[model samples]
Target: MQGFSGRFKDLVRRLGVTLFGIFELLGLPRVPEKKDGEGRGKG
Candidate 1:
């Protein structure tokens, strides 16, 4: 059986990383831009 602490920690870390990638793909408001403000590119 796996140790509880290690398994739990890994799960939390994986979850955090997964959530970050998901939000990045979603392009949420809180994410920072390389420029000073929002992108004004042609859509």
Candidate 2:
């Protein structure tokens, strides 16, 4: 069961990567990830 779940997670991640690549080809900007420590001197 653990192995199956891990494989499923990998599949989803790969799908997301493919979709993001397509979006990039269409000239769409990827959303920036938020910093954990919001404001200490990092933009």
Candidate 3:
């Protein structure tokens, strides 16, 4: 039904936002395996 689909879409959007925020907080923008001589130092 239309209502069910709408709810599902909203739920998925919320979950994506939450996961993205968690990643952002956990240093998602920084590369983990990069070394000092490359560019960015290790976190």
Candidate 4:
């Protein structure tokens, strides 16, 4: 039904936002051109 689909969409949107926040908290770097870049930098 229409209401069910709307609820599902909202749920998905909230989930996406929550996951993005968790990723941010975890310091996940976005994709880079090179495979071993950014997060894997030498200390």
Candidate 5:
């Protein structure tokens, strides 16, 4: 039988990859960029 921890890790990895792919397809930003207050008004 496989170890519980190993199986859990594999499940988590799969979930992460799946979620990332979905986000990529939807054109969503994974990480937000740090913007300075000065640039707020400018497009």
Candidate 6:
């Protein structure tokens, strides 16, 4: 039998892929990651 952790991981991976597909269908752009001290009052 398969392990519970393996099943959980598969579920999470599938969910992430589905969400990404929806985003692509809607033509949404991914948010850019924040750089080091970029928004930490370090101008």
Best by TM-score: 6
By lDDT, rank the candidates, best first. Answer: 6, 3, 5, 2, 4, 1
Stretches of candidate 1 exceeding 4 Å from the true structure:
30-43
What lDDT does candidate 2 reach at residue 3?
95
- Taking the tens digit of each residue's C-alpha lDDT, what string does model 1 give over 1-43? 7799989999999999999899888886574657765667687
Q: Of 3 and 4, which scores higher on TM-score?
A: 3
Please identify which of the two predictions, 1 or 2, would achieve the higher lDDT against the true structure. Answer: 2
List TM-score per model, in order.
0.59, 0.57, 0.61, 0.60, 0.60, 0.62
What shift in Å separates residue 31 of candidate 2 from its native position after superposition?
13
* lDDT (C-alpha, whole model) for all candidates: 0.84, 0.86, 0.87, 0.85, 0.86, 0.89
Q: Which candidate is the best by lDDT?
A: 6
Please provide, for model 2 over 1-43, each residue's C-alpha lDDT reduced to its tens digit, 9 standing for 90 to 100. Answer: 5598899999999999999999989878856767997656754
* Clash count list over all predictions: 0, 0, 0, 0, 0, 0
Is candidate 1 or 3 superior in lDDT?
Answer: 3
lDDT tens digits, residue span 1-43, model 5 = 7799999999999999999999999888756776787447555
- What lDDT tens digits, residue by residue, belong to model 3 across residues 1-43? 5698899999999999999999999987886776668875488
Which segments of candidate 2 are over 4 A away from where they belong? 29-43
At residue 10, candidate 2 shows an lDDT of: 93
* Model 3 quality (TM-score): 0.61
lDDT-wise, the better of 2 and 6 is 6
Q: Which of candidates 2 and 3 reaches a greater TM-score? A: 3
Models, CA RMSD each: 6.5, 9.2, 5.8, 7.7, 6.0, 7.5
Q: Tens digits of per-residue lDDT for model 6 on 1-43?
A: 6699999999999999999999999878967889986777645
